[model samples]
Target chain A: MPDDAAGRPPVPGSDEAFRALADPTRRRILDLLADHGSLTVADLVAQFPGLVASGISKHLMALRAAGLVTAVRRGRHQVYAIDADGLGRALAPWAARYEAYWAEALTRLRAASTGTAGTDPRE
Target chain B: MPDDAAGRPPVPGSDEAFRALADPTRRRILDLLADHGSLTVADLVAQFPGLVASGISKHLMALRAAGLVTAVRRGRHQVYAIDADGLGRALAPWAARYEAYWAEALTRLRAASTGTAGTDPRE
Candidate 1:
């Protein structure tokens, strides 16, 4: 039922990636990983006092499933890190489509911020 | 309870935007709007024969709330178009954080495809 039947390859893992990113907690987790480079569930749980180990574990599972993160067994702890390559592979094509739009939007934003649209600098 | 209390301004509407993008049907709707520039509910419904107008309407509503689309009343129809500026504002910060990671990943990807990583050709 997907429109990809018209000869274009579907963006594999993109749906799972989007769904995984839908949670604020998960996005926060990515932020932590990006900041720390890698972390264990305990490390993450410590970062979010309001959340429990189980909850963080569940979020990590979703992130892993989405190919947004990778887990490696390190001694007694499982280390988790952002899977940058996997993330790019999963969402780049879809995200790239919006680059031109984003660029134009940013130009308009800068114009609004500086209050200097269509004004001659020499004037 | 959000982690933004420590002096960082939260990315507004990002949670809703991520949630809106989680659905394939909704993503397809964005693609349609991007391609066509604008469309009415009936126009969108006609694009997907299996989905009814109400279903597409709900998707549009979610997209609107996420600031991903804008609906305008023209004559007897409500027209929808991709709200590029809004979309940039909502997701740019969050997405920008991953730019470095994405760039490195792309470099690795190119190296992989061309099988020329660290191969000095001046030998």
Candidate 2:
């Protein structure tokens, strides 16, 4: 139910996001994009000696398809950057469930330490 | 460099976590476990009419391997529950990078919205 920066409906679900993040090489591409703000395919290829331009492009395509990164054509080069909101939309809800569980756990820990196990956690 | 509940070194990296989460059926199994607190293979199979106990067991094994879920032997059945800390350890660092980006983005947004784009974002 999330929307893109252009107000368009979201591209893919968490499954695609998870799939896109499954590869170490693809993750390295994301880290590069995060550090550089934006980079061209040539720039990315230069960073990984064993990787070719086509291989980098394919990874970028998967990232783009998952809405995890955005590519904009500036002149002859397509520069890519992390789509923070898109990534959040794909991951936040899933992460929140676990976070809530952790919060409750911490509350229980605090209560146990204080010898207030019978009292309300909020109190 | 996360430690498990037993204080052992983490079993897998974010790559395995992402791969394990990429499947819809596996995700559904996680959702069921989250809501129910814990479930056995037979219990999980009952939830999905088309899925067999073996299929659910396979999914549980993948989940366990990813450090996303924990299994405890209670009598003859293996009861599975969400391993929130293990899940967080596998995912937090990767998620934190994007979170930092989002935080900076919000700062920029606040600056732009207030017509004070020239000033330092932190200020």
Q: Tens digits of per-residue lDDT for model 1 on B1-123?
A: 544333323666677998998888788888889999999999888877777788789999999999999999999999999998888877766655675555555555456647565422111
For every candidate, what share of the true interface contacts is present?
0.39, 0.20
**Candidate topping TM-score:** 1
**Native-to-model Cα distance after best TM-score fit, residue A87 in candidate 1, in Å:** 0.5
Cand. 2 Cα-lDDT: 0.70
Model 1 stretches with alpha carbons more than 4 Å out: A1-9, A104-123, B1-9, B104-123
Reference-based TM-score of each model = 0.79, 0.71
Clash totals for all candidate models: 0, 0
What lDDT is obtained when candidate 1 is compared to the true structure?
0.77
Candidate 2 C-alpha error for residue B44, in Å? 0.9
Q: Give a tens-digit lDDT track for model 1, residues A1-123.
A: 545332222554678998998888898899889878899999998877677799889999999999999999999999999998878776665666676666665455445747544222122
> Across residues A22-117, which tens digit of lDDT does each residue of candidate 2 receive?
777777888778777899999988876766688789989999999899989999999899898777666654554555544554544445657634
Q: What TM-score does structure 2 among the candidates reach?
A: 0.71
